[model samples]
Target: MTKITYVTTHGERIDTEAENGATVMETAIMNAVPGIVAECGGACTCATCHVYIDDAWRETVGGPSSMEEDMLDFAFDVKDSSRLSCQIKVRDALDGLVVHVPSRQG
Candidate 1:
């Protein structure tokens, strides 16, 4: 299992141990991590799963693809580092990852 720490804009911290095959959004929603609605359930269609991937981990987890990029444009408060958490799959390489939840999700 890999531990992924989720930090909210309000400073709430949620740490979850996730399986390698699960996506970040799956672990987050299942563990009740706030700010990610995941309305499309990892289909990469909804931006409700928007999150800011911590800068230190950006190289390992880069930006979204064209499709996910298009969808992100619709999310609220999209930033240079914004990403749809549902699209970030958990892997052994991503263990001990940390991401931040935005103040809003639309």
Candidate 2:
């Protein structure tokens, strides 16, 4: 398992453990960590799972696909650091991953 810390836009922080292979949003929703709605269930078709991966761990995360990028355009407060959590597969490399959720999402 990995310890993923989620910080909401209002600065609320939630720390939880997640199975190594689970997508970041899956963990959040399962734990009810708040901020991630995951409206499309990790299909990369919804921006409701939008998150900003911590800068320190950015290099460790996989890049977004064209579909994820296109959908991200619809998220609240979209930024360069934004990512669709459903697109990030957790693993050993992401054990200490931290992401910030925007204040709003579907």
The candidate that achieves the highest lDDT relative to the unseen native structure: 1
Clashes of 2: 0
Model 1, residue 21: distance off in Å is: 1.1
lDDT of 1 by residue, 1-106 (tens): 9999999988988989999989999999999997889998889877899999999999998778999999998899888888999888899989989999999887
State the local distance difference test value for candidate 2. Answer: 0.88
- Clash totals for all candidate models: 0, 0
Give Cα distance to truth, residue 52, candidate 1, Å: 0.1
Across 30-53, the per-residue lDDT of candidate 2 in tens digits comes to: 989777899889888889999998
Q: Candidate 2 — which residues are off by over 4 angstroms?
A: none
lDDT at residue 9 of model 2 (Cα atoms): 75
Best candidate according to TM-score: 1
TM-score of each: 0.96, 0.93
**What TM-score, to 2 decimals, does candidate 1 have?**
0.96
Give the poorly placed runs of model 1, Cα more than 4 Å off: none
lDDT of 1 at 100: 94
